[model samples]
Target: MIRDSYDVIVVGGGPGGAVSAWFAARGGASVLLLEKDRDIGIPVRCAEAIGQGGLQGILEPDPHFIAHEINSLRFIAPDGTRIDIQQTDEVGYMLNRRIFDQELGRKAASAGAQIITHAYVSGLIKNSDSIRGVKVRFPAAEKEIRAKIVIGADGVESRVGRWAGLRTFYAPKDLESCYQVVLGGITVDKNLISLYFGNEVAPGGYAWVFPKGDDIANVGIGVSAAMIDGINAKKHLDQFIERHFPKASILACVSGGVPSAKPFKKIHGSGIMLVGDAAAHASPLTGGGISNAIAAGRLAGEIAAKCIADGSWNEKDLSVYTRMWDKRWGDNQRRLYRLKETVFKLSDDVFNKAAAVLVSIPTEERSIKKIIATTLKNNPKILLELARTFF
Candidate 1:
């Protein structure tokens, strides 16, 4: 048994974990970061698409890690008619997530945090209602590492938060099954992101074409949990690509699920905290998490530092992270989740009708939200209910 101790232990080495470890170490706490994967980032599971605007509050992602920069977005309706919308603000980027995650981990290590790869945390060591440390299994053996604070930076299947008796299970309706194919030898504009939406295509979510430099693109689709049948996401993705970009050859394929729910009510407990996907920090509107993960991770680490600095570690003291995140981002997620629920319930016929109505609008007024409102305008009762729900 290789027992060790630290002021703070962060489980998972994704962006969230890395950021938490970084900030905790910066705050002068001895931090230990653990990852189940042999490396910081591998077996890419994300579409690697995010808006540059989403990253404003965190450390700027270095240019070497961004695969592509996009200035416009194209929307395709159910009938295959497309609408090209130029963005007034910087809109999108396709990232090299493998490099990105590694850089994040490196930043934490540079800040004096120790990292251990290939370590899977099995369970939390608890003293009645309080957490004390974690039990980990590594390639060589097993060990128990004690810590004053444990941060759950693990992804969606996180057992750390659940083991601590936190609400970590996502509702079926709150998840979107997604698939992505990184294609090379494809000629695309390289500066445009394409989004396709309709019940016939993506169910509750949407399909995206994120260009990654010249001759390459990351194409993907997200379908609601309710839409996943015997038909898997990859099969649907293949069909979509075959019909849309018949000549493109795939270089890599990725599959995962995005949690489209609001953040959990209880992410912080005595001596324990949950960050990133473990706490459902992904935005409900876009099904994006990278930026939010970094933001939440930093906040959690800073809060942990304060708790330790004050020599007080309790659920109430740790509530600073929960309170700060809720005040900044949580309400928006809840509103968007409610909006997603309403839209997902609409049938293809209704969506087609909505599309037709949207195309008729002037180009100057054809906004995504405006189109949705106009489509539902005829449903005065539902429109009123929706307004109340979102507003």
Candidate 2:
């Protein structure tokens, strides 16, 4: 049942929304978390990989949610040359997102937040220029749930941000159309994750093979939407699987849009705020957003509760979220955006040459920082640009 009012109402029950509700309720606010899907984590859309350090900081590591532990990553060139780098400092894990998301929601409910699944938010309730609440449609009834603060953690196709007057549209070049399938009966290196790069394999993006275990993996490809002339993501993925894992059995399939753009200039207006993909907070280069989403949601929730306590629920009061986010990840995202644009312009031959160069380096010295520096060595101007932005 929907409450008559709440101190905060968060839309979408992904990591961002769940964590936001968790923090908000922990801060003594009456929080309501809404999920359009009947289940919290059904229909996983992500590759479900997270750095060990980042995941540990968000929540205690649980064996129940971990599908595989990855200690190395291999990058393959168009010509089949591969550079393997062991994770001496940055290990990661493949997660069962379905279980992981539901656990997050459970934690939020334990913190005193109420969760309502299958509640579709149809629109924002506007009180003049400010967003007062959300209008939700349930299977049995429709209700307008009012709140002092409304957070839009509602993924890439979020209408809440648009309804609140935020510019949330992304350019075609700044979006990635992705498709993936869970494959069984295939033998992959259980301790290593693989990424393949080439126009033929995945135009303007990359294909990844994240091992779920010894016999199963999530193999997927992300193609730059603007570069997909007339082909679709699934066709590319199908061709890739046929060539790489011909004997693998397909178990499940998923497709979604990944935001490859920089975060919006404004994330808050009046009493409303945007987080996660709603604010386009994914990394421009890697298209990874899980770590950033959790962090953003937690920070936004804390700020929201504090604003309500202080009785200051205006744009000025909520602008702290923007500043905090920028200081934490937004600035880094801007730098990555520049690097992404520059790297995507490289020819296939250049990528092969870069891979060859990386392969020549000693395994111990093949840190990502060093590899990137060496790759751009011939382009002094681009190297200088990187130095100015990163250093």
> What tens-digit string does per-residue lDDT give for candidate 2 at 1-391?
5579999999999998999999999998999999999999988999999888667556888888888789998999999999988888887988999999999999999999999999999999987879899999999989999998999999988899999999998888999999999999999888899999998999889999999998989999999989997888999999999999999899999999899997799998889888898989888999988888898999999999899889888888998998888888877899888777766766788778778777888998888888877767855555665566565
lDDT, candidate 2, residue 154? 95
Candidate 1 per-residue C-alpha lDDT over 1-391 given as tens digits, one digit per residue, 9 for 90 to 100: 2337888999999999999999999998889999999999887778787788756755586787888677777777777777766665456778888998888888899999999999999999999889999999999888999999999999988889989999888887788888999988788898888888876678778888888877888899888887777666777788889988899889988888888887799899999999988899998767889888888999999998888888988888998878898999888889987877776666666555556666777777766666667756765545655676676
Alpha-carbon runs more than 4 Å astray in model 1 = 1-3, 360-388
For each candidate, give its TM-score against the true structure. Answer: 0.93, 0.96
How much lDDT does candidate 2 score? Answer: 0.89
Q: Candidate 2 deviates by what RMSD? A: 1.7
C-alpha lDDT of residue 190 in model 2: 83
Highest lDDT: give the candidate number: 2
